[model samples]
Target chain A: MIELQHVSFERQGRPILVDVDFEIDRGEFAFLVGPTGSGKSTILRLVIFDVRPTHGVVFVGEYDSQSIRESDIPHLRRRVGVVFQDFKLLRDRTVYENVALALEVTGAKRSGVKRKTLSILSAVDLVHKRDVYPDTLSGGERQRVAIARALVNDPFVLLADEPTANLDPETTDQVMKIFAEVNARGTAVIMATHDLRLVERYGRRILRLDDGRIREDMGLVKQV
Target chain B: MGLLLAFREAFRGFWRTGMVGLISIATIGASLLVLGIFGQVVAGGYALIDRLQERVEVDIYLRDNVHRRRALVLARDIEALPGIAEVNYIDQKAAAQEFQDMFGAGMLRALSQNPLPESLRVRMTPGSDLPQRLQAVSDVANSNKDVESVDVGETWVGALERFVQVITGIGLLLGSVLCLACGFAVSNTAKLMVLAQREAIEIMRLVGATGSTVKLTFLVGGAMQGCAGGFLASMGQSYASDWWTSRVPDLALDPTIDLNFWLVVLGTVLGVVGSWASLNRVLSAVSIK
Candidate 1:
């Protein structure tokens, strides 16, 4: 579960997020839709405690922004997965190595890392490209590798920041379907994107953000 | 698992930054080789000084008419002196025999009579004030009625002492400067390696890896480079020592295994420290996009 209580974030005298408040329970899929500079990524960053709230508190599971120790940030991140638009994969590592890194960071056993990494790669349909480096893969395949890495840890919440920004329409659809499948398997998903087409197609709970404020909260509705 | 990961990441980094890693190793090796050679020179100088100190003795020559019994009594008196460790009376006959042994029997045969004087060889106990003690013993011997002259080798011994002091001072100053340069070389290597892996490091931090985990990776890499450099330096030192010994047989220039092992240890420590310092400076600037 994630909650932001009247959070206000400012950077260099410019307000990025103002009085923003929201909550989403476990196993729910929500789209945080907003235009450019609407502070969607800042909210995701806050949930992971990458940055503290300027004026309010954020609660991610049992870690509160007000009291969380610096040493506890890594533990907090292990339970929350994040996917970036650029795919953020190590250029030197193979697909399997990249995915296994998620488990390796947690000091997982060798056999367990292999098993979990292979299983997650299978789930993301990237098992055949296990040994290939990220530089050689197509845009969609790289994104799938990134998705597998995020989900390999079985995080409770998956925060995606414009994960499909660089992919073609067909590839974006494939990526979205993966997110949908992951959500169906009981992980809460909060994807932030400026694309309206995705908002109309998925038709899950929508939280519209504008000018550092949540403009509207559209409840779950039927898919278009 | 954590240590294994650190090693794996360290090797991976080495492989990733191929030439840069080699450069780091070579830099450390070169620095250590220079240091090792300097150490050998200093060690050799001290060894030579020790051998010379052992040979130091004062000789009190007696007048030609002094009786052998009187020479023995003078030896006993010199033995009772404050700093004298041992005193040996050499009569005219024994002194002549020594002269024959040193300059050959033909030189002694050329003389009409045994002209070498009866003498007492006095050795002093080892102490910081060796030159002064030798001077005091010489003065006491000169006051004796039967004594003709005393030779303490004062001028040469004083020169040797000054040489020891000069070498020690120079060794400390040059050693400090060399060590600082070696540290700087290692620190620059670590900085370059960190810069090369900037993206990977940022990604690792973002993926929930602990700060220690990420740091351990780079630290291990730096240590490996340093250790390899040390090994190389030790090999070079051994080779140089052998060449020096072969060319100059009188001087012993062998480097012990213990010295080599210490060199490697020094290299490892420098590697770890250099990596830690560079990481402190660079890690802060790396932020998640």
Candidate 2:
């Protein structure tokens, strides 16, 4: 589960997010929508400790920005999956290597890393491109590799920021389908996007941010 | 497999950022080569200084009324001093012979007696060749019974010792500066390699990869580059030094095997530490969105 209680983040004396509050329960699918500078991405970063709130509490499982130790941040990150809009796959590495990296980095056995990576690659429908490098793959294919990498560790919650931003509609649907499948399988998913097209199509609970505060909460995504 | 994977990633990283890898190795090699050349010059300079210091000797004069047996005993006792390397006793008759050899006979006979006193020609150990050590020996001889005086070429010895000390000081200062320069140069190179692997790092971080695991690959890559640079420099320097010795003839520079070993170790440490520090700083500054 992820929760942000009245979290406000400031940088250089300027407010980025103010009085923002929300919570996503286990196995729930939530969407964070906002225009430029709406603080959608900041909420995801707060959960991951990339940026700390100027005030208030941000919690993901047992980690709270209000109380988490800096040294313990990495361990907190291991239990949470993150996907980037850039499809931050290593250009030089193969599809398999990129996904396997997640497990290998955690010091998983070679056999386990390979098996899990293969399973995730198959689930994302890129099993045929396991050894293909990102540079040679289509943008959507590369994004799927990133997804496979994210889900390889079976994190409790997934935070994805604009994962379908660069993909064509057909590819976007494919990527969104993968996200929905991941959610249905019991991993809490919070996706941030500026693409309202897919937002409406996916029809998940939406938390809309306007001027650094939540203005709309559909499906009561805020959680009572 | 984890460690091996890290090393694999490192080598892959090094290859991917070919230009940065080359530049890092080049700078590291150049710094180490500078250190190697300076070492040779210092070694050669010290050898020359030692040869010059060898000519400075102390003469222990025996008293005019001292018995011949007592004079010889005093000479033996003086030889036992820590700094004294060799002590040759020149009896009055031998002093007379030395004068005859120097001035072509007649000189000692013309004086009607051996005016030159019996002496002990003492050579000091190389390590104890300092002017202060010579002064201490002279003081000891002056305090001995049956010993008339201790005469050392004090002015020349002082100047030579000072000259050697200055050269050694300069060598030490330059060597330390060169080492620091190498460390910085290698660190920057490792930083570049870390930057090149930014995408790989982000991906690793996303999948629950611990910070250490993210850094391990970069460390291995940087360290391997350093080791390669060090090996190249050692080979190049050793070849150049051997050629230098052949040309100089009198200055046979040691093979520098020990220096080579240390350079390789330094290169490895510099690579690991530099990459680790830079990656940690850069990664902490970034977050996956």
**Each candidate: RMSD to true structure?**
2.8, 4.7
Q: Interface RMSD, all models, one decimal each?
A: 1.0, 1.9
Which is the leading candidate under DockQ? 1
lDDT of 1 by residue, A45-147 (tens): 8988888999988999998999999889988888888999999999888999998988898899999999999999999889999999999999999999999
Residue-wise C-alpha lDDT for candidate 2, range A1-224, written one tens digit per residue: 68889999998999999999999999999999999789988888888887899999998898888778866877777788888899888777789988887787778898888899899999998999997788999988988888888888888888899898888999998898899899999999999998777777778899999888999988833222
Name the regions of candidate 2 deviating beyond 4 angstroms: A10-15, A34-37, A194-203, A220-224, B1-6, B43-68, B90-121, B136-160, B209-222, B253-257, B269-284
Candidate 1's DockQ: 0.68
Q: What fraction of the true interface contacts does model 1 reproduce?
A: 0.54
What is the docking quality class of candidate 1?
medium
Score candidate 2 by lDDT.
0.79
Give the residue spans of candidate 1 off by over 4 A. Answer: B63-86, B110-112, B123-147, B254-257
What is each predicted model's overall lDDT from 0 to 1?
0.86, 0.79
